[model samples]
Target: MSSQAPPIVDDEECRPQISFFQWPDYVVLALMLLVSAAIGIFFGIQARRQKASTDDILVGGRQMATFPMAMSLLASFMSAVTLLGNPAEMYNYGTQFVVIGVGYIMVSPVTAYVFMPVYHRLALTSAYEYLEMRFNKWVRLIGCVIFTLHMITYLPIVVYAPALALNQVTGLDTYAAVSIIFAVCIFYTSVGGIKAVIWTDTFQVLMMFAGMMAVVFKGTVDVGGADFVWQKTVESGRAEFFNMNTDPRERHSFWTMTVGGSFLWIATYAASQAQIQRFLTVPTEKQAVRAIWINCIGLVALLLVCCWGGLVMYANYFDCDPLISGKVKASDQLLPLFVMDTMGSLPGMPGLFTAGIFSGSLSTVSTGLSSLAAITLKDFLIGAFKMELKDSRQASLAKWISLIYGIICFGIVFLVAQIGGVLQAALSVNGMVGGPILGLFSLGILIPWVNWKGAFSGGIVGLVFVGWMGFGAQVEAALGNLSYPKKLLSVAGCNCTTGVLPAPPLPGSYPDIFPLYAVSYMWYAPIGWCITTLIGIAVSWMTKFNDPREMDKRLFSPVLIAIMDKLPLSWQEKVNWPLKPAKKEGCENSGFEFEAENEKVQKSEDENTHKF
Candidate 1:
């Protein structure tokens, strides 16, 4: 897995290897791996000292500061797929893509106020536990299945993208890149649990910034300056935005990026278990809100940087289009190519970029593997089968489960090529998983009438509908039967003396005949969400509704309780009066009680002590 200078081309026909990586890059990469593993080992000793209570191992005893938790959440969500894909998006489509950030205008409030209040009140190990409490076990089962599918599908892209970038730039073998990164990720995550994951994520997020900033500064300087890059991109028609198109078929209009993209955000940021798991890691609701703000603010800033990185790429390749000239096979390759070409002038900078790419990749896989294990153990094995292991045994089993998921994630990388491009593939799969969960959970919060049957039926429909529409269009795009508009490029000044000129461009194809299939991928989450909510409501009317008197108060929202309280006594019974938590005394306990398991381990194995 050690990095080595790749074999150079011997023939004249072979263009000179422009970015051959050297010894310093390998040294930097090794240091990054060592630091990550060391964090795990440090946490391992801490666990041994305290005999590692369940709370400490799983949720940092709910005592982590807001900063690293925020950093971990951001790194977990932003893959190298995003780090590289965003800039390529800016280069090819222009600046209109940045409007996707506007979706957060609603995202911050909705998650902090609506969703956080519920999850924060319930100190469950897995968010899917809410499903069983609100609806029934079957509904909980569906949520777990889709969430498992979503994470399983997503981590492969995280695994593959950085490997692809590093392989192209440093001539590092793709297999070695995947193997080395995941091995380090698995080692840290399996040994350290949640605390190690959070701290290492903080360190990796720093590396990600260092790597990206290195490319941005060097590339910007090489392209003259940020002002020149902007001027050239705008003049060349690569800078664009605010096209208020009403049609849903247009890929990235303000309407689609904001109106449609908001659904994508709410679904993932509010509804997905991967994120909720982080929210529960905090001790208090206030810190949870604080962490959410940090992630939202930090993400927009990073996106702006990646956007500028794209402009720098366009400026540097202004006349010598790498894709057009066949210097790279895909647009995703452009970033690594730019980094290698520009940073090759320095000794260790290329390694820094390589470490940065792997940083995002490793963080993503580590978080996914860790969270999936918790879900598998808590929601599936323990909740479903009533596995009654002692706390120490459960913690040990979690490590084994994490290792298994790491192995599965690595294997999936080989099959992920057919899943679509990096960014589109991730968002579409997330949307498909996220939409139904949002619908199911929204029903739990808003509609007390929805039972297990209704949620189950509605969720299945949302999953099928979103999957069919999203994946169908992705297939067409993959086959080249579907394509998006790209800003024109010219290679007139490439300085290539030998190879023949790029082939002429292909003509555009007709739009898909089915309007549903042609709708922007950004809209898939919204469409699936709407379909699920509507269908769930309709199904509730047709089937047996839950007797509200029999239900637990924690299943409903405080907003609903507030509205019911103001109603007159006559109207109150009509809407199911005496909901348990409506009483002043009972209402104070929002069911966020962390009920520690009674089963105990030997003192030597699990000395549960209050920690600093």
Candidate 2:
């Protein structure tokens, strides 16, 4: 499973000021931020007349139109990471990575049929609230904590990816780019709330499509045409896919991208708060589900364009191999370099493209900040305060939390880097944090026997294992240790002064690293989920388990229930058991009931059961 370090090639394209940026570009970026601010102000003003409730700021008062939610959902998913890193992924690894979208497509139906129904029926303000109902407040807290870790690790990378791109594009320091993104993103998001986020996301989505299209089409034409690009790609072996390799350590085989990626999509969408929050902004469950479908379609289309843009980049630089010559400092720099190389002649084109990148980054960061803020207020703070606050107070709290979180996120940007590649780095971190979360939730919704105890234990163990594996791999990559097998390029056709690509440098040759750590980043979520679910189920069975039938039907999975119903009567009776009802007030709580609050416990558990 061990891989050799890539041979380092001499540099020719690594020059300072590869191109100069125009004034129109600045204006384009400026106008995009200004428009973002205006959208926030307008939404803020409208919300005030309605007394600006917490729901208004957090979920757009559940008055958001369909198209906007769809756009925002996809834009948020398109993070600066995706905008810049996706192209880099294709440019380096080839098009096999694009098949990851199959995993994405697989998650949509589950979101519509399983996860959304419970949240919608319960009117959940926070996704973790469902955890509290299914297990206990303690379990909800575990979910909240895991989600916070996920967002904290993720949001910083979101800011850093485009900042790295900006550094390459405009000679802007990463600090300056990070600061500028933070300011605009914080201002608009804090003022406007979710509604502002939605509308701005819509505009940004268009800019994203426009910018990507311009680069792709223009670059394709410059390289010859669509046919020319395809011929070059296939000839270069860059168009290859269907890697039937069964090696668990193989990075992007079909199973890894589609099967492994399917869980990442679940972690990213079905189990994610940013997406679910956007979904709930619409008025009806149907509209929310519609948004989910729209999001899937848009995601595939945008990602495919970005992937093709990568191919076009390859066609244009087929022989040059920018990475070998050091023209590109990082893989992430390839796309920006290509844009400047091809479209730099048009005055506003660079601006439009850069703004387009910022658009994707801003939308994602704002969405995360807003969602994290809501989770903080609803899941963490409000409950911790042990009392209800006024609607106005709650709304104010959400805004302040969002503002503060945005600032905190910026501080983490210093931690971002080209560890391997930004795309893989971000996803590995996401899997580390998100896998256990999806597992915890999956346990809550499917295995009625799972209790807070098993959830807590499983979550901690799963997080530790996945987190360890993810960071170990990243550290190795950062240290030039772990290497993934990839197609090599030749300098024979590169118009260069340098001699034949210096034989790729040989390594000191160390022993193989752990296979667990070598599993592709694509498998992180699935592994994490499996660990947590399996361990959680075992631990729950060892303790006092609840019968799903005795609990709120909404808290469990509709799919699980349907399957259970179809089982033979004898098997169903053998597999299911009733949860023991609460004892007469003198006993210690096993987290099934809480703090002698009989009325509240009854309302949360028994009431829902009665309704079902």
Candidate 3:
């Protein structure tokens, strides 16, 4: 197989390069946009007819279907980066990253049992609201700020990545691609809210699956078969899975991928506003649990296909390395380049693949916009400023907020394109903040003794420590002082001219950076979690721990309550356990409290509502 095949190798033998992008391609791409926009318009009119409130905009009125919400959850987390980057990851580093799915499996139960119950009881619009209920306004404000920064940074990269893919395939300018796609995303998200985002995601995820499957199946067939692809990848030393090295500095080891990756995903699924909002769309805790596990199954499946796709790419280019051959300028560009080489001859197939990449970007960007609007409205305007407004006006403000964020993300896309190298570092740094946020939530829900002071202090310290480590590591890599040992690649069978090939695999050598800075990027979250938890516990004891009985039992996870119940009577008394004495109602929080918490919280919120 010639890896260097171009769209127009010879006019006589091959179709014109112009025919590579035919009318059918544009039609398929247009249908994807129209369908996404129509979903938003449909929901927008429905909401207006009912005079839907802010809650409806943020959480589908808490009446969403489980399967759509499940698809939405999966789509929100799997962005253009995952769609493009995962395969490249496998091609370069081997399949050790596939074990990350195991982490997803481990965290599903934790997200369901530990975090879902608390969020369901609180009936939160913003996940940060739990920070206020468990800690105080200061901690909540900090959390809201971190989330805002994280989303703003992340959303640009999400939109920019697929824009790059579009640029690679269609000769479209990056700016135009970002503008067109982001405009559609913002329109649907602003007008239709969470309902629009969820339905669009469901539609787009199917497109994502179809597009990726096309690439995998077609690429595999062209390369020979699944067995050939597998054998080639294994011969190339890329079929690795279990790497038991315990060294934190070793990238993609079994320990880092599972334990550290679990903490990272737990933070995402259990604490991030975007995902928690998805969980809240369901009506019951059981439905929410079911939705999360369904998301788990879908995520694992998507990851396996992506991993397989990487092996297929390797097989096609085993004798002729694309990067070294200068057929693709970057590793991320390899997938799109390969698509054009193999599938460009088949009209709408190329468009479907492009739409799939764009769909990944669209789903994530829309999700981020919706989450940003919800967090800004609930955490800042309502909670911090105490700006009470009528439900209708609140809904209107949320739409405006969503629109503003969409524009901001679009503008930032240009900046991201300018400093492309830093995107990976920015992503790593996002995890640094994520771990502390997860720690704060974990403390609030699982540890009754942690107080507001402890949470605030621990979060601040953890952020600083992780930030220091992440920045130092990124700087070293940029300076060519840090590098990971990748599986060997060759261009020995190339029929065309080639550039300098990468060095063959070398015995691993530790980077001479500080020991802590040498830790694998995968372990960043685990490090932050440890720092935050240890400091939180220490600070709480010094400040006199929170009284478990004084706090709402609804704030604690059922798992913690069960363990508290089994404690020795003396230990229970010493720790002020039993939370609050069970009434004749029979300690429902102690068992399985399915009902919404006392309506007093809602009553107070309603009383606080102000007319426009």
Candidate 4:
């Protein structure tokens, strides 16, 4: 009586329903698979017909053009993580994520000017091999290990997230989705090699851009207009264009993301085996530089689309709360939900979006699988087995390795699903592994005084330290004991509970404690580098170890040469130098002579003998 008989609510009014999929969505999903398979098969056949050698398969015969190389790089870098994660980032935290593009932009110029020249000049198959020339075999091995670990952990997450998205749109099982995607990718990559990867990546990149623009255009129209949507976003405090104030504890302050993130970007693009290997596929430094600029422009344009897509999500849910409406359960599903709800009725629209997602995911997975196989074959298998695959058989081994690695990655995708927040997890793992590897490479290049012993020791210590810090933060986050430090706090914005419900409650609640020691993810690279270099220099002084005098000059940056020249006479001059130069002029050159001589003298009497 007091409640007026519970308002006589009807069941239909009490429980609202949302359409998950339509016929058009299924049609789009089918088209996505068909197109991806067609591209893969076409390239796979082309690669087999070419009978591409190992070098050709791994590095595109070192003859890639500027446009294709640039497009491949862009496609590889802008995976589903960028396509979906960046927008989700803006929707959740604000526009601070755009600073990532700034860091990426800065990295491109530095890569073109500083890193590309050295990498191109070396013509290395694996970037880590340069470490051997700069320092020692151990340094090279360590670098390869780090790259292997980083790729294994990082690439799986990239593969899995997009599969999850596709699952939402296509109603396919996540594992089935992952298997279909990777099988197509692996088949093409195993057969076609890098040339196949490059050409396919170019097509995927175009699809990515087209799909993203379509989403933007459709979203803008759905939101009433671009101006109205942007205004609503601005008023909601999601369209923050700039935030210059520095706060180390913040996830992304302007200075933190700009300066610190730049170093991380440098590590990934300039020093990483994945990106460096791509650059080396081209024949010359100039073309590599051109590719870098092309990628830079593409990156900026792609990020703008991603950020705008986030605003579209906000605009679509401007009045209604999808979370309350039961449209979706998690924030990750927001964009997919929006696409299905807004454009599901249109012919080919849902398929276009699905195709775009597959393009992003498969492009990334294929590059990763191919690169991982190449690195493993060149860096680990050959190093350990002492067996040489002849030119005739190298492509066969590469193809087999690509197949194996792709399968491994496909399995790892299931594991990645157990982890949360694809972008953050990917970056965190990358920082932990990539930072120390970058530090080691930087030490080898920029600090020549860091001898093999010192470099090895410093790398180990840096890896341990960064691992502890990153893991500790992750644990604290899991325990619900982490918070933004007071100094990092921004003004409170609209607490919109749209599209997703609040995260499920934990087993036990704990007091909120701000993480004062937390630093921006971007800072990890520079910090790790600083730690490794400083430790290396100190350890070198203690141990009195110096690089061999005959090491290649290309391995040392200008700064390192200056440091070496300033060092006073010490044991370095004695142990690292020959007592007398050979009678032949340029006999001591660190080129074919050094390699040939070392190989000849070091090889066992056995005809099959080989050494790394």
Q: For every candidate structure, what is the RMSD over all alpha carbons to the true structure, in angstroms?
A: 6.4, 5.3, 6.0, 8.0
Query: Residue by residue across 257-334, what tens digits does model 2's lDDT show?
Result: 987888888887777888878766765667777778988999999989999998898888776677665577678888
Clashes of 1: 1
Query: How much lDDT does each candidate structure score?
Result: 0.78, 0.78, 0.82, 0.70
- Candidate 2 yields a Cα-based lDDT of 0.78
Tell how far residue 429 is off in model 2, in angstroms: 1.1
Query: Which tens-of-lDDT digit does each residue in 1-612 have in candidate 4?
Result: 001111212334224334455676667657756666676677667777877677888887777777888888888768887887877776666787787778889988877876676666556777876776666667778888887777777778888877777767766787887787887788777877887788888888988888889888988997799898878777666665577656565567678777777877788788887788789777666677788999999988998898889878877765554434444555566777778777878877867886788889888887887888788887787753557768768778888888887877777777768765777777777777767787787777666556777888889998888777787777777775653311111111213221323332331322344442366566677678778888888898898756445555555554444455566668437545322322222222222222223233223323311110
Worst 10 residues of 2 by lDDT: 603-612
Relative to the true structure, candidate 4 reaches a TM of 0.84
RMSD of 2: 5.3
Ten contiguous residues with the weakest lDDT in model 3: 1-10
Model 3 gets an lDDT of 0.82
Tell me which residue pairs clash in candidate 1.
121-592
Show pairs that collide, candidate 2. Answer: 7-504, 7-505, 13-327
List runs of model 4 lying over 4 Å from the truth.
1-32, 483-517, 545-549, 558-612
Runs of candidate 1 with Cα error greater than 4 angstroms are 1-18, 418-420, 495-510, 547-550, 563-574, 582-612
Model 2 off-target regions past 4 Å? 1-14, 417-420, 493-511, 577-612
What is the descending lDDT order? 3, 1, 2, 4
Query: Residue by residue across 205-234, what tens digits does model 1's lDDT show?
Result: 999999999899989988798889989988
